[model samples]
Target: MSTLLATGFSAVAADSSSPQELIAKGEYLAIAADCGACHTSPKGGAAMSGGYGIQSPLGTIFASNITPSKVAGIGNYTEQDFARAVRQGINKQGQYLYPAMPYTSYSRITDSDIQALYAYFMHGVAAVDVKAPQTHLPFPFNIRSSMALWNTLFSNNKPFIAEESVSPQVNRGNYLVNALAHCDTCHTPRNALMGQDDSKALSGGSLGSWYAPNITPDKTSGIGSWSGEDLARYLKTGHLAGKAQAAGPMAEAVEHSLQHLSSADIEAMVAYLKQIPAVNTGGSQSRDSYGAASSTEQQMRGDQASAEPGWAVFSGSCANCHQANGEGTSYYPSLFHNSATGADNPTNLVSAILNGVHRNVNGQQVDMPVFGPDANFSMQLTDRQIADVSNYVLTTFGNPKVSVTAAQVQQIREGGPKPLLAQLTTPAVMIGIAAVVLLAAILLGVWVSNRRKKNVARK
Candidate 1:
């Protein structure tokens, strides 16, 4: 697959001579897209056997097993069945997959790539016969048919077309970002319908507990401060020393997907990302250009530990790995000049505190100890205590503007606010409701008519 550097992927994928080449290409494509991040269960199931429960506003939407199993997976799926499922969000059984699968972004996958993917799924990977737990979204959301209308309105069905104006490399990068990598699934803000708001594309999107920061090259609010190398390093390794570190979903992405891409593909992605239009999400300072090292660890040493809740927690729990100055070692990323802490939203910062950094990549475990209860390593911090420590870190080593509330910490802990899309004026929900109502009325009319006939017959 390293031969990808030798020729254009679009061309190479199409001209691959043997089944092995096609399978290899598909494997590489799957890595770039991070398919396993969603399909593979974090709770230790067979690879791609899919018991992974994705937390959405409505309920936990479980990912279906995509193994090539005859009974439990997609072994029976033809190429067309696989294509429809991947691009159009329709299953082999003609069911609508929830948008959590990112088929909208995958909709741009070229036919050749889709074929490669299909082949790989069928041949390259070992099949597991485990069935995924069925998703039981409450009420109207459970009506998967409504998604057809949603798709009609929101999803772009056309495949990606390489713009003649852009360089071939940039075009390749665009394909990866929009189609395969599905960056917009997290980075782009959603509309009221929970669809990607293209107007604010790559500006920043909410992941309930964590916020995906703006990546549109804005000097203040986004990654405009990062050089190409810095961005590439951050993407590949999930850290940039003094700049930023990945946690939550982004951490998983680096561990599973981005780190596995070839050097050529990485460059292509950066090249495309560099030229995208800058969008401002209303931050006055660069996320990576905030705060300084504090000597709180020193200040709190001996019996002089300040009673301030945040400082006390930081001095006691955080000062060990992060150091007294907040500079941190190579393994432990510094708290200051960090993107998560410096962002306008404290969600990411709070999230990291609540759910500590955990990623295993390149044969090493990069773990920040968890503070939450049940798994409360050394620190069994409460929600209020976590909030205080969050505020303390923000004020001392991160942004001074933003602060976390105990309620907010609790909300993040419990998957944030549930924005009921059905509660809105969405036509899709209304139509489903109307149809149900109409059916009920028809049934009532039939019952009344039958009762009248019964009386007549009795007479």
Candidate 2:
């Protein structure tokens, strides 16, 4: 019995390795998990010392400092404790963590990867004593127990299972894209309960001031037109085909995570994304109209339009850009057809119009002229006007169920929009510009020749 115990101890000792190798592996896994994107403060703070605020349907939750600070961070956590927090969404005290941590997806990550991540974060990562801000949840939602109910209905504990029929690479890609990356959490539309509508995976959704575009392989509504090369380029450089670039949450994903991943891993992600079944959530199709808003208009007109101050304000300020028809310009984007306005939650719409969208078109970062006081543009609209306009858009053209207040819009405006505009020209716009320039040059040359001939005759 003593010999057996000695043998077990020897095996455990053999498994333990040098700290440097463990830390290096941990760094790679951390990148794969995109931990820094949320845990690290955006304004150049120490790594893993969280201060970034994540907006959700429930409330605005600030990320906790994962740095090895005993009092302020996860320094006291052991390997098993870290694993539980990451995989099982539990804190060291055994309290359930918010889904905002994306542990529902991370639950499928290999144990080996989780150990490596734990090692790197606890040892290699420098400790910082930054205190995390409390999440500002309204009323009864402030109760952590409510999350348990939310989890019971939506949470799945099962790990990703590889399909026997699919290729090994494809399966690996599927696992990474669906489970580990949790891409669907943002891209897929949600139900009234704010749970992901699995039936409509990768169809597109709005988060804060940004819209996660359709990624499924649908020719008209999704990314069927984008080649594998386009996906790779977008992931690598955050630019694609001069039409779209990664921005908002996606930009963070690219810069902090996807860009650092192996080319093979990226390819696997692309492969998995391509195979995702196309689902049409009937979001905005064109820039003119948000799509169909007859049902929403009918519902809103019957219910509290007169009592809602936002309705009157929206009619006055938003009607010009969005139009009374709610069909906006391609350059402007029609609110009626825009998914951002029509989302199950109105947080993004409130943030976007108040802050305005800054897009990169043809290497030019075109700022969506903001009417808010904070922006250097027109400041005709007050906070109330901004709130009313947002409310009106969501009810009349967007989802009527989701109501936004003036105060919420004010808070989001203070946070600002995600900065990830790419500098590149669209092919169609570039050709048109070139053609006009060539014609102008030819006409100028002809005028010069004619003027010279006339001058000689006069002499």
Candidate models: Cα lDDT each: 0.86, 0.67
Best by TM-score: 1
Model 1 ranges off by over 4 Å: 1-12, 300-306, 420-459
Instruction: Give a tens-digit lDDT track for model 2, residues 392-412.
Output: 676667656667777766756
TM-score, each model?
Answer: 0.90, 0.63
- Quote the lDDT for 360 in model 2: 43
Rate residue 276 of model 2 by lDDT: 77
Superposition error at 78 for model 1 (Å): 0.5
> How much RMSD separates candidate 2 from the native structure?
27.1
RMSD in order of candidates = 4.9, 27.1
Q: Judged by lDDT, which candidate is best?
A: 1
Q: What TM-score does prediction 1 earn?
A: 0.90
